[model samples]
Target: MYGFEIEGGFTFYKFRDFDGSLSLSDDHLKWFWEKMGKAGQISVVFYDGSVESFEDFKKLAKLKDQHFFLGFKDGRPAGMFWLNGFTQRSCFVHLTIIPDFHGKAALQMGRGVLRHLLSVTDVSGSYILDCVKGLIPVMNSLACRMAQRSGFEKAGVIQKAVYLAAEDKSVDAAIFCAVRNNEVKVSE
Candidate 1:
């Protein structure tokens, strides 16, 4: 039932179930795969930054250092977030938001998700996170702007940091960094 209620009086994201558990399941993964499959582009990261086919997604999803989680809106898959490169205080974040989600609500949802993920504590009550990073493809200007609005600030751009399967070329990635702080507002 955890969701973001925007100005229009509608919820833009719903990641939790009635029992307060995040609705993470094979169904979510399947939904993500179908979306990526339809787009004809692979969204999973490669260890060597080489482009790989969809066949590798399931196998690579088990990579020890990385994990994926799904977010929802109105009981439908809204986005998938890949959290990787975890260290004591930081991790890399990658995202694939549903193309249909548009406008201010999408931006608000991004902000809320980032803030919630970074600020949340586990049952043990420990704070093992200090920062989260985004290496967004430079061509995706909307994502870059969304990151800025979501508490992530520009770090720098890395050349050929991401492989664009659709374009069949490597693209520059815009580095965005968000440190753990109380200033990340969950809503406007």
Candidate 2:
């Protein structure tokens, strides 16, 4: 039962004490989706399909075969992370925070979520995080730096085609992979 409270308890909490198979009802998922849609500050990067749709949420939720929900805050879905491709010894983390919760203070919350996720899982050998290129530049930088600081090395980048909002058609998306020190744990 590890958790941290911030802002004198105004409206943010980071929790990490549950297994990967955490569940949420349909109502909460829909509510958070609607809130994210309306919030101009929030932008979902992996938008190839109807990510905000309940079907997508259900898919991601049940993906606990190698993932888990970190927890929620202020009744809004805070963040969800998972480890994909277990045999590949890789874990991918996705974060969706309600716009109202995005700020300098939220960095700790994000770090806490990552730390908690990394701490709980065996990790097999290495972890891979696929995120939008330079998305939320400051935060992304922080996350990368944090991952490195936590003893993960930047393996390299894998470019994949994806649609860019600024562009009409799909383009190469840089996927960054960071690996822990042990090579036996992750495959090249």
Q: What are the models' TM-scores?
A: 0.72, 0.56
Root-mean-square deviation of every model = 5.1, 7.5
> Which residue runs of candidate 2 sit more than 4 Å off their true CA positions?
1-22, 40-43, 50-52, 63-70, 74-76, 121-154, 161-168, 177-188
- lDDT by residue (31-82, candidate 1, tens digit) is 7677766664354433233425444664455455556556566666666666
Worst 10-residue lDDT window, candidate 1: 6-15
Which ranges in model 1 have alpha carbons more than 4 Å from their true place?
A: 1-25, 39-54, 165-170, 185-188
Summarize candidate 2's per-residue lDDT along 1-188 as a digit string, tens digits.
Answer: 43434332323222222454234455655665566667632334344443545577557645545343434665555544434545443455555555565553355455454444444433574333322112222224644454443334455443444554433445443343433333312211
- The global Cα lDDT (0 to 1) of model 1 is 0.64
Error of 2 at 69 (Å): 1.5
What are the lDDT figures for the candidates, one per model? 0.64, 0.44
Query: lDDT: which candidate is best?
Result: 1
